[model samples]
Target: MSQQKSDYIDEVDVDESWDEHPSRDELEETVENLEDSGFEVEVVEDAEAALAFLQDEIPAESSVMNGHSTTLEEIGFMEYLNEGDHDWENLYGKVFSIDDDQARADARREAQTADYFLGSANAIARTGALVAADLSGSRVGAYPFAAKHLLVVAGVNKVVEDVETARERLHEFAYPFENERAQDAYGVESYPAKELVYRQEGTEGRTTVVLVEETLGY
Candidate 1:
């Protein structure tokens, strides 16, 4: 069975203060900065609106893939990508369908370059930086340039004061929850082997930040 947040909430020690949503001023400033940094920003009211935004933004025939993201799962994107009736090529499904271990690994790497690659960030700074890390490079590797387009969906709760606080939130807040989930799912601990501080995106229209109003992920 898949690991859920409930399974690890009590086991981890995180700062509850990091889970609070930012104020309207913070949200507006963050959005403006993000847009100035060359990221397409979309603020949605809730999870349903976030999902609807994705469905409308992505074209019918594009190839799509996503890294492991609790926010994405919480928003029902994972289930929709696997089971929903959509015309997009599900590169993720195809990669996992391979029975051979070597082939599957190769497919996973190849899928990182999909037409549309989606994932969530651990923290988003009010100054417009995004921070995320993974035990392996599977998730953050595609964010910089490999994928044709990158979509990052994060909740307002992730917003911090600056890049330093963003990284602090990643370590003190996000890592605990992710570590618990990793242990439950893989029977092993997780580490932030590769970290990313995404300050700006040079590619116009290549990266989109979908910020949802509600707190959805660690």
Candidate 2:
């Protein structure tokens, strides 16, 4: 869909602190302020800590459901899990994409049984809102409700100005990643993500977002 055609969405402009991209110093200040807003905050220097937190300390269950994102692979996630620590009796991505029969089964089984869930976020507002666009449903659906605890991991590049820009960034960047995610999760290369995401409107769920300071995938 054309960008303008996608304008019938809720409009929330970030007119307060993040009217523009926060500088390094401003970014720290913003993070501090956001942490004070009743949300748990963890700042990692680079992708290494993010990787360790995701694959090791977060939690390990028989099933670990995740989106088909390149960031996970870039951080040596598959290697880390394949090498050791992660149990071998569970599933990963089954229906998170329109993949073939085995891939579909993998995603469905993982989402059904996984106690620990993780996925990349397109943007993390200073208000601690986790934003994403899910076509295969891995971005937010499984992470927010299916998992015991949700860890929203995003590279520094995903951090944007405010809520409005965050939504804009989804169209600019996330859709493409979703396209790749579709290809990997299935095996087809023509699937593009639909612009529908689930948010925590009236749920008392806890979502942990780890913001990294280096450039990473979408």
Model 1 TM-score (2 dp): 0.97
Winning model by TM-score:
1
User: How would you encode candidate 1's per-residue C-alpha lDDT over 1-218 as one tens digit per residue?
Assistant: 33345567789877699999999998999999999888999999999999999999899999999989989988889889999989999998899899999999999999999999999999999888899999988999999999999999999999989999999999998899998888877889999889999999998999999999998888
For model 2, give the 10-residue run with minimal summed lDDT: 1-10
CA lDDT, candidate 2, residue 182: 47
Candidate with the greatest lDDT versus the true structure: 1
Work out candidate 1's RMSD over C-alphas: 1.1
Model 2 Cα lDDT, one tens digit per residue, 1-218: 11211131223332222223446875676466455543455678887888877665455444565655556656666556555566533345234345587767665745743565666676666544556766655445665456766666666666665667778777655555555544545676533354433334233335566777766655
Model 1 residue 192 CA deviation (Å) reads 0.8
Residue 63, candidate 2: C-alpha displacement in angstroms: 3.6
